[model samples]
Target: MEKQLSKKIKELVLGFQINELTEALVYERIATFVKDEKDKQTLLRIAADERCHAEVWKSYTKEAVKPKMGQVRKWTLLARIFGYTFALKKMENGEKGATKAYDEISKEIPEAKKISEDEDRHERELLQILDEERLKYVGSMVLGLSDALVEISGTLAGLTFALQNNKLIALSGLITGISATLSMGSSEYLSAKSDGEEKPFKSALYTGIAYVITVTLMILPYLLLPSSMFMVSLSIMLLTVVLIIAGFSYYVAVAKELSFKKRFIEMAGISLSVSAISFIIGILVKQFLGIDI
Candidate 1:
């Protein structure tokens, strides 16, 4: 029974080592394919780190009383067959899951706790790298789109309110929406190119396209509604509420150090403040500038 338990443990260790190697390979491929210089550097660093972890586990496997060499080669080949993109996503999911698994298993296997800690650290590092890389792309895309959507939507809504049933309100909304989409898309594309990072042009272009699409989608309702006393206002309020909820949820998820309630309240407060300020400015521009519908 004792021998069987030792064999089982050795197999588990070898399985984990194979996973580390697979992750290392995935990172290496990502490092090679990534065009952004910063992202490339980060991937290379992570690959190197994973390689070191594989070596550590290799050493442990060799020194163990009952060595169990699992299907490492087979698994590695299978991962390669799946292609780099799928493999990378798998590695990310595996790392995240392993972190939680390690945390749970550490309570029972005190001696293996060190290994678990190492896995946890590596998982965290990988997650951080992913988050940083995503921030560079995702945040910028979302910001450009959300900014245009809210600004244009709010402008059209306010104009409709002040105009008191002018058809020009819908026309202005269309003009602003198109202009904002073009301007924001161009700005995002240029900014991405200007960053001196060699990102996959297709990826960057897609992100820009997504930004434009998001802006257009958000502003479409305003244009679709016929000139009414309150439909535009209702649509604007609904969009604003959706944005607030989505934005607050993102803030809470990413704000690691802050409690959810605290982050929610803070983000909600800031959003409300910004909305109030924009509305007041809109009113003033209409009142003082004497802009005609």
Candidate 2:
């Protein structure tokens, strides 16, 4: 006869059961749209592992449990938006604590140890074959974003004090930003070509897109606000810069398994420092030149 689980152990086992089933559903759903055969196969295999885990837990719980459809939908939507690699990494990171739980539960149920080992294997497999396209051009994206943040943030800061007119600042920023985007794209293209990169044009396109998007976000406040609200617009623009840095940093951190805090602080610090210096220069220039526009 099988050993009966205690009430507390049974409840914990059932929770893991639900989690495993939900993840299985999520993986199966993601596999449908995945184009690569290898990647699709990996996802399906992991989904099978998840199902097996749920079954193992079910034997102990002595009852059936439903998959968390909400969690399934959430992961599915995240994968749609952010790509499967990020969503998978984020999901895996969320489940790290479960391994410890399984370890503790193994004393009551020997099968828990096997389930834990399977979980570790799932991670190894996913990490090995997760080849999302967007991740390939992260360097280009970072180049464009970092350059835009540093250059445009400083330009906007200087113009906000020097011009003192939101409309004028917006126009100036748009012209400068668009010109810089083209130049950066062309430069990246040439650089990639010289470096013998396989897809130079695509690299340049990614760089240009990242640059233009960052420029639009950074200059949006000035365009939307009144001339008298230059200070407010500048403040909002600066905050937007921080937010962009934070968001990009988070995305890269999750997708690449890097340090979020370190990247955020470094990028934010450089962009704000340049902006501060330019702001001071703007004040001094305005005072000396006596040009009030």
Cα-based lDDT for every prediction: 0.55, 0.91
lDDT of 2 by residue, 1-293 (tens): 87888887887898999988998999999999888788898899889988988898887787988999999999999999988988988998887778677777887988778867867886666666778788999999999999999999999999999999999999999999999999999999999999999999999999999999999999999999889899999999999999999999999999998999999999999999999999999999999999988
Off by over 4 Å in 1: 1-3, 6-33, 36-108, 126-146, 163-168, 178-214, 225-233, 244-293
lDDT of 1 by residue, 1-293 (tens): 22222555556666666766666665665566555677567667777776676676566576423212243344345344533333344445445555554544445445566866766676566545443344345546545545654565456556654564435665676677667766666666677678765674544554556555654555455556665644555456546645654653444244222355654555445544555665566677778988755
TM-score each candidate: 0.50, 0.95
Error of 1 at 195 (Å): 12
RMSD of 2: 1.5
Summing lDDT over every window of 10 consecutive residues in candidate 1, give the lowest-scoring window: 63-72
| Residue 94 displacement in candidate 2 (angstroms) | 0.8
Of candidate 2, the 10-residue stretch with the lowest lDDT total is 121-130
